[model samples]
Target: MADALLIIDMQTGLYDGPEKPFERERVLATLNLLIQRARHAGAPIFYARHTGPAGSPIEAGSPLWQLWHELEVDESRDHLFNKTRPSCFLGTNLEQQLRAAQVKDLVIAGMKTQFCIDTTCRVAVELGFSVVLPEDGHTCMDTPALKAEAIIEHHNATLAGAFVKRTCAAEVRF
Candidate 1:
């Protein structure tokens, strides 16, 4: 019945790209707020850094693969891991780890709203974990078909009902 915080792919390179994620500062601020609140509530914090192929933005051990410098993380207490797929559960031991820690609920937030956030939230529910997706806590860069804001809006609406409990960062409860 415990809740855990899963921060996915909020890496430095994502922000250093040509187009920064939409509402970059807002998302970071919201994430920091969530981090502080989760810490106070004694919730387990999990950081999932996405690893990409060599020479890619998020290549393993590369500076781009590192978490955003502005994001707050306490390595001493928070769990850290890497993933190679869009869904954190795929190609990762996230599920087993959460189950082992008795975490049945999750607060998922980070970058690439249309990909990692969307995929992870859906998969988390399928795995039987209740998920709270903070609408303003995840973001992405603009694409040819849609603006970053539009993508965030679309995903938030798309995943709001059955897939995840949708809420803003301020309303999310640990």
Candidate 2:
């Protein structure tokens, strides 16, 4: 089965804040490498932008809503879609597009590991797509109850065996 890559909510506003995600620089570098590798492997790439309500950081049409300038996005070859909810499939055509391309294995990476990343991984498996979640590719800010490192570690362990295949960005193959 061919594999596809899904980059979720990697917006400029998410990183330009006081509280940044765990290993922000490393994660961005990893994601860019993943993108390059996927392109070389002829894998389809999909970018999902989260649209928050107006006045919010990532409100639609706002500068913050734009994808991070550092990301390796090629509009001519990649697909971009907007979503509001945590799950990328909930209100988007992501599933349909993946199915149309005959893609059954999905490699997901991007921001807010505790929210969009977590939700998308679970839903992708339920949708019959085998998901490869790069353990170090997605990240988030610390929460009141837990540090970002703990959250990322927790989700990696929790989602590893059943929901998705967990691996580091360097170990992930397109």
Candidate 3:
């Protein structure tokens, strides 16, 4: 089976935000570079968008639900899936698509470090796929209790090599 790159929740809302994620530009650069690498390697690349409830920033058909402008999506090859839940497989055809592509491993990246990224990585493991989380490719906004940096660090430390191996974006292989 082949490996696929699973990018979760890298949408416009995360970029154009009242509560901005730390180093969004850096995260985008890392993600874009890796995405290019995956494309060159002929690996499957799936982009998941979180469609939040109505009135939320990412409500369906809104500008915020769109993919970040800088993140180029190739309609001819790459796939984009909409999800209401954190885990991309839930209520989506992600699992079926992966299985169809013979994907044995998932190299993951994207937004909201403590939520969608973490949940998707864990669920991928539970569903019997090896997961490689790119440390530099996911980000989150600061909360009232924790700084964005601390949240990123905590998730990296806890989730890194926990349910999946954590590698730098440049080092992740599809």
State residue 60's C-alpha deviation in candidate 2, in Å. Answer: 1.5
Total backbone clashes of model 1? 0
Across residues 1-174, which tens digit of lDDT does each residue of candidate 3 receive?
228888778888877677778898999899898889889889999999999898987898899899988986787899899999888889999999999999988888888899998899899999998888887889999899999899989988998776978878878765
- Show the lowest summed lDDT stretch of 10 residues, model 2: 12-21
Error of 3 at 173 (Å): 2.1
Please provide, for model 2 over 1-174, each residue's C-alpha lDDT reduced to its tens digit, 9 standing for 90 to 100: 338999999898886677888899999999999999999999999999999898887888899899999999999999999999999999899999999999999999998898999999999999999999999899999999999999999999999989999888888776
Q: Each candidate's lDDT (Cα)?
A: 0.90, 0.92, 0.87
Deviation (Å) of 74 in candidate 3: 0.6
Instruction: Give the TM-score (vs. native) of candidate 3.
Output: 0.95
Please give each candidate's TM-score. 0.96, 0.96, 0.95
Off by over 4 Å in 2: none
| Candidate 1 lDDT | 0.90
Residue 91 C-alpha lDDT in model 2: 87
Which of the predicted structures, 2 or 3, would earn the higher TM-score when compared with the native? 2
